[model samples]
Target: MDENYSLAVPFYDLWHEDGHVPLIRELLPPLLKGVERSVIEIGAGTGLVTRVIAQETPAEIYAVEPALGMRSVLVNRLAEDPELLRRVTVLPCGALDVEVDEPVEAIVMISVLQSFPAEQRAELWRVLARQLEPGGRLVFNWRERAVPVPGDLEVMGSYEVGRHTYEVAGQVLEVAGESVTSRFVYRIRQRGVVVSEDEAVVTNHWPAEERLVSELEAAGFSRDAAPEGMEVWRLP
Candidate 1:
């Protein structure tokens, strides 16, 4: 888990429930259509995407989330429904450390690729391959990203909750090779007055599409057709 999210947990769902989640809701069902036995979800933050997976398939879910704060919210969300509580098994560990009783049919990773840096992705792929059945599928979202130019603070998203406004602002601090460092500020306001704020500096890696394809191919995965902005690779 990225330590950065530990500070942003309170505002995560508020910002993301409307951000890219709707796209995940739209794209994931088709990707997960035939996974009937089991699925592993890496970085299951706040159960936003987790709920999408649960609703789309009857497969038992091994939801691996490492951050305590995020996991708490995920557990709380699952507790709301008896079926979710029964079917979704939360794994309290990082992606590389995740373990399941057996190889699963598929693994879904949403907005989580950046968390694993270029050097670690090989091992990440290896870990994923080890836990997937032969011919199993790996589904994740990926799009070519333009190199970032250092930028000043800009408001990313804002939402109104009760009388308070929760706002997220970010600034690009540095760009080196495949890594970008940025600072995110989470703010709360009431009656236009700032009430509280927290900040986190997060670094994310962005590998070229060619590099990703090469890495996955080297790891024994072959490309499969997928919707735009999503990639599906199958182990053979």
Candidate 2:
């Protein structure tokens, strides 16, 4: 995978330590209350949200993450809690590809939707729709945008991840005699595990909230906006 993403595991842990866990813990319960008994978390990333869900709800939990590195961390983190471990199944696969033996009461995407390309996001929604039992719920969050539309949907909830401010000092001169300076902005991962510097390609698609509503409607869901940082779509 991408080295940058691979290196991100450590950074992701650090990011969560800074404050991501509390934010996720705060927003998760309301969504959890709407579901019945089972919950599947797509892109579970080291179980930050999973831990919260397990603690707050009585539902069974299944966490899916495609990255080996992140999965390892998740497994280790849940190792001590035999009951939670028994109730949870950590799979190494993306949400669009996983097969569940039984229908689920709810499917959560959390910070995962932004990581998908447009097509993947659509496919993921479709897959989740199929997995839902009648009246099942899908809950997820995205970065908020100042403009009605943003270049990257990932930037919408960007503040949750925290911002990086930095300065540049020296410049490099090319053979042509022009001096250039480079500046970069970084985002901190608030909760969950992230594989950075890996070969993985992380893309964000922020189709407007209306677009998401329309898509859910097309997929046979009635959508509602939740104040805790996500949109809730319930199967009709």
Candidate 3:
């Protein structure tokens, strides 16, 4: 998994260059109006959002990313701005394992929550509940699954055949004749050690607006609308 992520880091970094930074910049000010002291970003991939936070907010920023490949890019990008670099601390850790000596006023998750598995999503929220100061904000964004793609009959038949062969062989075998389906799998890690696997199937969950809201409530978060693609929660 680490190798796969490392290989994709460069592409991911490049993909964010096309106007994403400005988009985040425009959306952040309202949510961050009175926030001060310290702000921490979880899953700070390539520092796209980190750059904006450093520029627009006066608080000390801590960017936490578990992937070394992503962290390296962040370190390099912040190298030139000593003023920004002075207020920033880059941690090679994930949300679950990050320990800040001082309590933070706000925690930003950006597009990171979907990366946690269903079983751990609640626990992740519980961890956040502990880390954040009372009344502090927890902001995140999730890709909404709008419409469902019907199951392909042909693929289902092929999958059945593959299952039969695996049962007969008593060992896992890659079925060559089966149609391959690719989906994003979110995993959780602590300091480079994988703590959980296959946490969420990005495409299969939250297929509607109601489901998205319900999931947030179930995870102990009370959500309010944000500019179109984002959601903001005030921690209780």
Candidate 4:
């Protein structure tokens, strides 16, 4: 699955502007405060989470994102604010491309693990294992399927930004084993007239929860007690 988030950058804001803000604001602070060294955030996206981290923690941050369109939007946010610029470094790279001078105290991936192509997911986990310092934390969330091999349609919701109205609708395109491919169609209109539209098809690698925990163990992580809806791990 090739996801060019650059093409969807314009609608990215409409789709998820502050969508995960409360979750990020709530989940990230305690984790960052626990880490004495730096924190690296995989898939920084539009940088709202990054902004929160910058505001809440004193730790330096590596905000890694491979998509230029999303990166530009996030970088612009850093430029617009002194706080983000002071503590955050926007890295133009993805999971495998990560290389930091110092081993980090934490590695966070929010809504990023599923996007890794199925073939490369093992390596992705391996990289995550290697990035953290001993006793360091790895925090992430998984895409939950209501049932095995789900094929369903979702309204996804819509919103208005300024005078423009955006409607986001999506449906399941295919389900292969544990993985599901979905299609999203975005229609932007002004004054009830369609102005622009685009569509994106994404396939996520979703395995069963047991298998996922097994994979993380195989990648050299032992699970630590974590809150519901999140996974926390520590390196031996």
- Each candidate's number of clashing pairs is 0, 23, 1, 0
As a whole number from 0 to 100, the lDDT of residue 28 in candidate 2 is 73
TM-score of each: 0.98, 0.74, 0.71, 0.91
Residue range 24-87, candidate 3, lDDT tens digits? 7788778787877889999888888988777667999989889888888888888978887898
Q: How close is candidate 2 to the true structure, as a TM-score?
A: 0.74
Compose the digit string of candidate 1's lDDT tens values, residues 1-236.
35678889989998898788989999989999888999999999999998999899999999999999999999999999999999999999999998899999999999999998998999999999999999899999999989998899999999999999999999999999889999999999999999999899989999999999999998899999999999999998
Q: Which of 1 and 3 is the better model by TM-score?
A: 1
> Which residue pairs show backbone clashes in model 1?
none
- Which candidate comes out best when scored by TM-score? 1
The candidates, ranked best first by TM-score, are: 1, 4, 2, 3
Candidate 4 segments whose C-alpha is farther than 4 A from its true place:
1-3, 148-154
Whole-model lDDT per candidate: 0.93, 0.66, 0.64, 0.78
Model 4: per-residue Cα lDDT over 74-100, one tens digit each: 999999988768888888888898989
lDDT of 3: 0.64
Candidate 4 matches the true fold with a TM-score of 0.91
Give the residue spans of candidate 3 off by over 4 A: 147-220
Backbone clash tally for model 2? 23
Per-residue error for 25 in candidate 2, Å, reads: 0.8
Q: For candidate 3, give the lDDT of residue 194.
A: 47
